[model samples]
Target chain A: MKAFTTHFKNSSMTTTADFTNTSSITLKLEQVSKQFGNLTVLENLNLVIEPGTFVAIVGKSGCGKSTLLRLISGLDQPDQGTVFYDGKIHRKLNGHARVMFQEARLLPWLNVVDNVQLGLGKTGKGKALEALNHVGLESRAKDWPSVLSGGQRQRVALARALVHEPRLLLLDEPMGALDALTRIEMQQLVERIWLETGFTAILVTHDISEAVMLADRVILLDGGKIDLDVKVDLPRPRQRDNPNLIKLQEDILRRVLTIPA
Target chain B: MSINWSKLTGRITGWVLPIFLMMIWEIASENGWLFSKILPSPREIVQAAIDLSISGELAKNIVASSERAGWGLLIGGSIGFFLGLVNGLSRTADRFLDTTVQMIRNVPHLALIPLVIIWFGIGEEGKVFLVTLGVFFPIYANTYHGIKTADPQLLEMGRVYGLNHWQLFSQIIFPGALPSILVGLRYSLGLMWLTLIVAETIATTSGIGQMAMNAREFMQTDVVVLAILIYALLGKLADMGVHFLEVRLLQWHSGFRQ
Candidate 1:
């Protein structure tokens, strides 16, 4: 484990130097209202995330959490207002942002390294190898994506997202399909990478415990609006079983359950 | 130093039944329990094959038939593949061409023999045209289906990663549709032989079908049987070729690996 940590640190140092221009981004969504036909998914939703901050949006299904992430990523435009990136009005697809979806979505025809290279767009086997190593998948570089476990595939997806060195990383329930142990491991890996890279991350998940475990601030959404915005002022490498963390998780869970459908 | 014993055994087992059946047929014919006038014995068929080979007739007929099939596949397969690609990738192309193609596909290609003969006049052109028509639809349908049903999620991911149109089509769309396209190729190969057999038997002078027709006029059952066996062997060889291609190309597919 110690050796793995040191190796990760060494690789990240090189990546940091290579991507020195990729500073973190500030995201601001001002009165962003989105409607699909008559069903309003997000209504005048206002949000501001500081650079390098990890924020998790926790909401029930149909609460427009994924839609909000899509809006921020510029995949979908809000009907009413604007999305600002670094105080500039962002109009088209957000070039500085990369989204990790619920499914890994790796090309089945390509091997592990080739799929990672897809993230690079052009030829860069060396850089692809580095990213694969970051995700501890360098050994399986030549293997197909179909052979990987759910967690391992998601890790490759994370590596693909990170290879671009995006200023904003949007995660739309990336770990939602993982098993309990694998999900925890992925959470730790993501947290460790986020800490090292300092990229702004916005995770949309239904798991409150996961939100508390990873994010600096947990934003609870109910009926297309933010119901609660709580700051998690905790130390790094937080223990899941820690009394304070558990109490906060339960408090958030209780609040989430109290909202009427 | 080590052989794959199980694989070897599996191959040996597959041949056992066919060899046993041939032996039975040979013994039955030798003992006069079967008449050679209707269905010739295996030995007689082999003798007929040797005679044809010695006279160079078998080689000539085989070459003629193969060339026709090859040319037809090259032209028809190329047209089908490109059309399928266009329709699969673009809604406009699909709207303009898909309905017409599907309507034409419903017409039995072999049933157009009368019109084909009239249009091209019993020459090599008619046979090649019939084979081309016969080999086109399955490929077009399968390739289009494969592309149309590609995982939208993967395409979305490709877009998010900033792949341009050409990159997305070459890297994602083409490989994703390949398995289905190969299925079309295999199906089209079978149709290629079937259409050629009909076309040749109906109006040709140089192919294996014509050789069989000539043998029938002289009551040479052995030569007729030989021709039938040749067609069967060719069809099997074509299928094996496609299977080899699938194994090589779809190594990443779990079903094709090993």
Candidate 2:
């Protein structure tokens, strides 16, 4: 993890994006409410995400975390709300945002490089290889997704999301399905990449520690609203065995589990 | 030269049973214990095959049959694939078109031979029509099945990745549907031969079916048997061809690997 941090620290040569200015793309969801045939999934929720900030939304199943992601990505419409990207109001998908799903969801027919290039459009060959290299999957560029391990497939998914350099990157429990060790490694990988590119990153996960690990701010969702928002003021590459981190993680977990259905 | 005993044994396994059956048939024919009228012996059939080939009659019928099947398959397969694409992509198309297709598909295509003869009048058109009808249903049904059953998760991924409509169809939907489409193709090929034989019942002067029907009129059981063997060979060859194609195209999918 520390090694990747150093690598990302020197990643000025990797990206051409102008990340010098702190003022960049921001996500604003105002009075968001969503329902499906009389079942309220989200109700009057409001949130603001500044650029270059990492935020994780932790919740139990059916807590509307995935619904929030769908609304943010323009996959689902809010019943009574508005979502603004940068300064523009979000209506239809404008190709400026990308999402990483829990299942990797790599097209089984496409090879690793082709899958990465999918979001980049037709002439995305060179950049796709670069993105694959970022995820440490350059060796498997020509291999099919069916032959890859579960972790590798998600890495490819991450690479695909990052290849196009989206202003906003939405991760819908991307690491939830991975094994313990692989999940830790992916968290580190995502951290390094996010630290490097500084894209607005939003992660929706069930794991409390995962929220504390990568997210600058952890929001605990209970019912249809944000019940708790805690900032991780600790420095990057915080030790896994740190006492303060464990306390914060435990506190968040307690809050999440104790919330009444 | 060193002998590859295992390889040789493996290669010979497939041919041994057919060769054994042929030998038994030859022996029965030689003993004069077999019926000479209804089922001509294997040796007599072979003689008839050679005679037909020498006179170029076998080649002519083979060409005629090939033309009918080839044209029908091309037309029917293309139309079915198109309809499948439209219906698979649009719910409105499915509502408008699929119900009608489902209704028509339940009817046995061969039962319509009399109607086709009336409409097309014993010409090449009637035979082609039969083969086309036979080929249509499988391709349409399988293509629809393939498209409808495409992984919804993959479709979601495609949407998130900002793929346009055409890109989504080509990159996601088409490859996902290809395996089922190939299965439909194999079934349709079998039906093509079956339908052509049925179409030949109209007493047309050409094609393998007509040749067999013509031979039956003269008690030339050998020639009749030869034509049947030709149909069998043609069906087997078509199947092998499709199997080869599946291997070539779907080497990535483990289900199609062997």
Best model number under TM-score: 1
lDDT of 2 at A60: 87
Candidate 1 scores a C-alpha RMSD against the true structure in Å of 6.0
Candidate 2 lDDT: 0.86
lDDT at residue B98 of model 2 (Cα atoms): 86
Give the C-alpha miss distance for residue A5 in model 1, angstroms: 36
A61-162: candidate 1 lDDT, tens digit per residue:
999999999999988889999999999998776569999999999999999888888946567788888988988999999999999999999999998888
Per-residue alpha-carbon lDDT of candidate 1 for residues B22-80, written as tens digits (9 for 90 to 100): 99999999998889998889999999999999999999999999999998988889889
Give candidate 2 misplaced runs (Cα > 4 Å): A1-24, B1-8
Q: Across residues A89-202, which tens digit of lDDT does each residue of candidate 2 receive?
A: 998876778889889988877789998998676789999999999999999999989999999999999999889887788999999999999999999999898878888889
Compose the digit string of candidate 2's lDDT tens values, residues B1-258: 799999999999999999998888878878877787867888788889888899999999999999999999998898888898889888999999988898888899888888987898889998888888899989998898899988888888888778888888888888999999999999999999999987885648799999989888898999888888999999999999999999988877978765
Chain A superposition TM-score, candidate 2: 0.90
**Pairs in clash, predicted candidate 1:** none
Q: Please report the candidate that would top lDDT against the real structure.
A: 1
TM-score of 2: 0.93
